[model samples]
Target: MNSGRLTNFLIPLLAVLLGVIAGSIVMVISGYDPIAGYSALLYGAFGDSYYIGETIRQMTPYILSGLAVAFAFRTGLFNIGVEGQLIVGWLAAVWVGVAFELPKFIHLPLAILAAALAGALWALIPGFLKARFKVHEVIVTIMMNYIALHVTNAIIRFVLSDKSYKSEEIHESASLRSEFLQSITDYSTLHYGIIIALIAAVIMWFLLEKTTKGYELRAVGFNQHASHYAGMNVSNNIVLAMVISGAFAGVAGAMEGLGTFANISVKAGFTGVGFDGIAVALLGGNNAFGIILSALLFGALKVGALEMPSSAGVPTELVDIVIALIIFFVASSYLIRLLLTRVKKEGK
Candidate 1:
């Protein structure tokens, strides 16, 4: 890697190492065995084929969600409404999957498509307002999240009143399950969603790195005024970027609905997947491959947290604390650079 990219990466890796060290300290002070806790954590994440499969299953939505946030960031937009977009998309996917009865090949793709379109459309509301009126996207997207939540709840209640809590399970025709994969993984919930997520990550990477539309979108993101002066349609690109980002978020929702849960449940609050995407994006430095690895790391941590309390008498909250510390250090990466420079000067 070039010096810049290498530095960009090394700093974050260092931050992760430091976070682990900090977590060890916390465990030691809390009357917990740090070594035992981490041993349990590692064992829970990969001790068996089943646990490994579960980790990958958990990573499915994370990859797509991270890509969603990364895409918006690439376009110089903050899509704070990923939670809402994901919810709506998930609802839409489940609604379509349950409402339809067709061949698996046909029904599955349609359900997935429905989710992407729903997410894209939800994002367009804020995208349009920002493009047309120059409103701040962060505020608009945040408000849109609450609107999405209430609207989705009402839709769910109205359409599937028979259940009264969760939507009906989708027909098997629309399911994304993979019996072969499950069998191989010792009957874990791991589905074909991982394949879809990997494909989506590739698409996102290609779209950003190897296309004219990507160039324009990124150019618009970097400097709207300059792009406008350069004869680009800044407004259109802005809206387009958001739409694409929302579609990815929607696909993430579909992973849960069609692949994981196979039904949509009413929520008293926003699903944490969207928020976690932000951390994944940050940890990945907004790169597609990086996001995949980061998602795996997070997935392992999440699954491992379940074992900590039982196996080592460590509170699961320590995982959250470590994650927060990692984020803080990453956000303050300039400090890392300054320290590096000081060491270099001292060596000189």
Candidate 2:
């Protein structure tokens, strides 16, 4: 690899090594077998086909959510409302999925598109305020999150509520379940969503790296004043960025509802997927390919956490501790750079 690419890879690799060493120290202090715990974590994440399927399932949403946050960041926006946008998107997709009786060819795509549009519209509120009134997107997005929560809850009560917290299942025709794949996997929830997520990631990479519109949007993101002076429509780009980010978040919701839950539900609180997206985006270096790998890594950690407490006698919370440490190290990028520079100087 080239020098920059090599450095990027090495940084994350070093951070991961540091995280593991730190986790090991915690395990030792706790009088646990660090070796055993590490082994279990690895096995739990990838020991079998079933576990691999679950990892993919979790990664699917993580990928989209990561993209949601990363997309906004590329445009100089911090979208904290991913959780709310995702929830609303799920509700909208399911609502439309069951409400209509269109053919599968049309209904499936319609449901997905509906969620994307819903998410985009919801995001527009903040975008509009920012563009028109110079309101801070962070504050507006945070407020929009609560608004989305209450609005979705109210809608569930009025429109989709049964005795259960969940809405009625989407029509079979509207569902995105891969019966054939499930049958092969003995009914694991793994579906075609993974493929969809990868496709979306590729498209995002192309959009951001190879398109003129992307150039304009990122130009605005880097320097709105300069972009406007250069005759680019800065306001329009800002709104467009949020809409695109929201659309990705909406797809995350749709994946949950259609591929996993099959309906909207009254969540106990915020889903936290949107918040997780922030970490995922940061860990992935806010790049499309990086986000996919980061999502998978986090997904594996989550899947492994469930088994750690039960099978390895390590508290599941340890996984969080490891993840937090990883993020902490990543956020402190200068540390990695310094370490790399030191290594180079010493070698020379």
Candidate 3:
């Protein structure tokens, strides 16, 4: 590969290696066996069909959430409000699933569509503010997360559930759960959401790499003033970017509601999936295929962490620390790149 591509690939790999090393150090200091811990983790995540199925299930949402963040990054927008968009999308999806009854073909797509629209509308607030008023998106999205949490919770209690903590179970027609997938994977919660996630990835790749509008979005991201001078509609592009980003996040929520849980519950706090998407996007270099790989790595780590406590006598929380370290290294990749450049110069 060319030097640029090589560097792009090496950065995330190096970050993962450093994070693993750092995690091993922590394990040793904590009186745990790092090899045993990691072995158990691997076995837990991929030892059998069941674990593999579960890992794929977990990866479903991670992929979409990563896409959500990556898409906004490509368009010069920081969509920190993915969490809020996801929550509203989840609520909207579940409401449609519960409130409607129709053929499987229509009901399922309708619910998913509702989720995408809800997320788009939620994201539109900050997008419009950024485009029209020149307001910063970071602050608005952060506040909107809290708004989504409480508002969804209240709606579930009063409107959807008749003062219950969760909404009614969705109709079978609206479910994404697949009997064939479940049976093949030893009845694991694997669903058809993975298909949607993969399709979304392809869509992002095509939109960002193959289309004229994609060129405009990336150009705007690189230099808005130049893009405007080139006759691009920078304002509309900004809003459109956020809308597309939110749509991705909303589908992520639908994976949970219509596939994993088959309903929505009152969440006391954020799901953290949206926040994790930020790290996923960063580690993936905001690339589509890279995001899928990173999401799988994260999914394996999470699923394997559950096995660590039982088999290796390690705390599952250690995996969280490792993830944090990975993100830290990724965020500090400028230093890593500088070091690599110096090494190359010295070698020459």
CA lDDT scores, all candidates in order: 0.89, 0.85, 0.91
Per-residue CA lDDT of candidate 1, range 1-348, in tens? 886787878976886777778788877887888899888888888989988999999999999999999999999999988988999999989999999899999999999999999999999988999899999999999998899888888888788656497889999999998899899889988999999999999999999999999999999999999999999999999999999999999999999999989998888999889988888888888899999998998788778777888888777677667556655665565677789878868998
Which of 1 and 3 is the better model by lDDT?
3
TM-score of each: 0.95, 0.93, 0.97
**Among all candidates shown, the one with the greatest lDDT:** 3
Q: Rank by lDDT, highest first.
A: 3, 1, 2
User: On residues 1-348, what C-alpha lDDT tens digit does candidate 2 reach at each position?
Assistant: 998788877776677678778888878887778788877777777878777877888899899999999999998898988888898889889998879989999998899999999899989989988998999999999988988988888888777876557688899788889977677655778877788789889989999899999998899999999999999998899999999999999989999988988988776689878888887887788999999998988788777667777777877677567656666665565587787989888999
Top-down TM-score ranking:
3, 1, 2
Q: Record all residue pairs in model 3 with backbone atoms less than 3 Å apart, i.e. clashing.
A: none
What CA RMSD would you report for each candidate?
Answer: 1.9, 2.1, 1.3
Worst 10 residues of 1 by lDDT: 322-331
Question: What lDDT score is found at residue 32 in candidate 2?
Answer: 78
Which sections of candidate 2 miss by over 4 Å?
Answer: 330-348
Clashing pairs in 2: none
Q: Supply the global lDDT for candidate 2.
A: 0.85
* Highest-scoring model, TM-score: 3
Higher-lDDT candidate among 2 and 3? 3
